[model samples]
Target chain A: MIKLKILLNKLTPGDTLTFFATREQVDNTCAPFSSNGYQVAWDQEAENRYLVRISK
Target chain B: MEDSANYSSTFFFCTPLSHERIIWCTECIASGAGITPEQGRIFTVFLTGDALFSFVDATSRESWNALSKVPSVQIVADGDELRLHGLCVSVARAAPGICITERGGGTLFWEQLISHLAAEWKGTKKAAFLLCHPPYMSRIPVHMLRFLSGAYAAGLSPELYAYLDGLHNIHNGQRPSEFENIGRAIATLARKSGESGKDPWFAACSRCATARGYFQMNPGTGYCEPASSIDEITIRPLKEILSRFPGFYPILSHTSGGIVNPDRSRDQDTRPRLIIFITNPPYGTEWTFGGLSLALATAMEGIPTTVVFIEHGVYSLYGTHEVPPNDKVFNVQEMVAATLDIPSLCYLVHAPSLERRGIGVEEHLIGIREVQNNDLAQILWDHDYSATRILFF
Candidate 1:
């Protein structure tokens, strides 16, 4: 989750970072990004996979 | 973090398990607009889902073989040892457009595309997406809403064209016990866009809506009125979609449950031009019908459009076809002929596809410019990397 945050922190204000992760990873990542006023959204791609997007 | 300004933009590619699908991806990546290793685009290709094990499959070996030739494509595993006959999985281009690494675990393609929209929406300040799936039954409606939400959060106006069964999304008073309330979400977004003075435009096809019972004849006005749908949507004729297209940049549409756009660029083109490739036969499925519908619709609206019939799609233009009275299929050849009259629509038939299928130019529809395989590659490269979008059906 920290690695995901690090990945997202690199983006500019209008940049959206898309990564493949698990549900837990997305759930843990969303609050940090959203609290910072960045937009985060995700959808389940498969049974175990979730595609997460966070925009800064 | 690499400076976002330095690189054109980031792109993600997700492929399904089918070898043919992977072959398409390989072709796109190997082609000019795909990777552009010499260019500044950052690509993270996800081979997750059923495609994760594609490297080991016998039928997919050829596809992977083609992917290996692409510059900077790598499959990293076990101390960075390149596996799968020295062919790697995933294509990631780092700074200066040199390094390539296959990130092992990743999300699906649609998620990646939705994520990429932020960067895509930045230049346009407006994004238009086609919603053909009805709500509740398919998760695509939810996904579309998520995409719109993300775009809205980034300050981009969203335009939704509910066509086909997509008209079901705008139906009023949707209350799902276990799933997201798509209708309410759409209304909220519409309200927000209206508040922002962005001229919120959420339109559904009147023809389709009336067919789907979303529109009814009211005796008082003697006109078709929206019924059982949220107030945020306006039912309009299908041709009106053309006007909406020019007003937005980077229009996107997908087949059911899938995402298709591959390249996202920093250079933005406000001109809404479309290139639709028909690679399937006319009567086997709805692909030809749908592709031609969009081609005619957009061209009628005067957006410069090109329709290329490649692979089996060349079959669409070959010979005269007669669907028997009992058979429900429309003669796709007639559909191809209908577009010939549209001045703005240009039709191209792949020369190699014809040769492979033993089809001659004289045997097919007239007015189609025959494009060589190499030239087709060049045309695709030019459109895909810039503001123009290339769609495959």
Candidate 2:
């Protein structure tokens, strides 16, 4: 939750952001962000990284 | 091979007769002269026996007649061409007044004849032309002989002709051997120009050629090499993308002699870090999967990672679409999607299929924004999330 606060302060519209979290969090976490009008993109696990592209 | 002693000009011609019999006669003539076959330059011509009578030049005609009369030789001529089947029967086809005009002396004509013969005729294998000339000489005009000799070589089949045509088109009038090395490499890769297959690197190279005009096609070599600035763009993008994530250490491992390893550094404080990998592995080689596996292992060691599998289809990820009766196709997206519920994890899936359906980076992030503002985001905010990492491949 503290990190989310920091991320919210750091993030803005049109900025590119990345995140590292377990598979479970990524799937559930994005729905709320998406319903609020932010853009999001993710790729399947390539090597060890799941790529997500976000826009607000 | 004594280099000095073997330095003699020779010519060759194709005949309907067997090459083994002609070589036997050549050895006999050499023996009769009290010398070995290697001592002098000899030109052998191959043609049918019935074609010998068309010769009108008295000297060549007489020589052909006399050679045919020899007990060891057999003459067969068809139309304007003649084949002498015996030792040293060097006449291919005889035509009356078919003289080659030269600005220089008549010796130049003989030299030209020698050059043409040596370059065009060596033997026939698999019913197709097999021309082998000394490496010291340029092997031009061999392309012409390939067509002429095709009838005796392999039934003059259309497939053979098409193969020759492809060779000609690729070379742009250059000799076949000019691109021999690269041609062999391409063949080894089981690829040809404009053909599509599972090999992403080949596809990438072809794409690079088509889009940027950076790769030059060497038909004889059966390979392509970078020729322009555009050629470097594909590799350069990876470097640029990786440079953006300063917090994540990069590690590049060289899997082959031609590829350079990228830079990777590690720091203990950045326990959760993002990593990106981008590479086009060689096609049809075992290392393609091995390379992917290694990249995966590196990511699982606590460093978040993303890999771009360029030009390859999803089939490579899961062996087949019709999953076995007992098991299901492993959906990487579903697993990553499940991670949304986890407090400490974030997952994103960017696939061409998904992108085409209007689910792209921007759209995905919008979802992230919504999730962060809702009750889920409130819950995480109340609990205080840990440090974050971002991985790109």
* Candidate number of the best DockQ: 2
Alpha-carbon TM-score of each model against the true structure: 0.63, 0.19
The residue-by-residue lDDT of candidate 2 on B253-339, one tens digit each, is 111000001111122333323322222222333233323332333332323443332222222332212335775333322222223
Docking class of 2: incorrect
- Compute the interface RMSD for candidate 2: 16.2
- Cα distance off (Å), candidate 2, residue B305: 56
Q: Best by lDDT, which number? A: 1
Kindly report which residue stretches of model 2 are placed more than 4 angstroms away from their true locations once superposed. Answer: A1-56, B1-45, B48-54, B78-125, B130-393
How much does each candidate deviate at the interface, measured as C-alpha RMSD after superposition? 23.5, 16.2
Name the TM-score of candidate 2: 0.19
Encode model 1's per-residue lDDT on A1-56: one tens digit a residue.
22343455456788888877655445533543454456878889976568877886
- lDDT of residue B108 for candidate 1: 29
Model 2 chain B weakest 10-residue run by lDDT: B254-263
DockQ of each: 0.01, 0.03
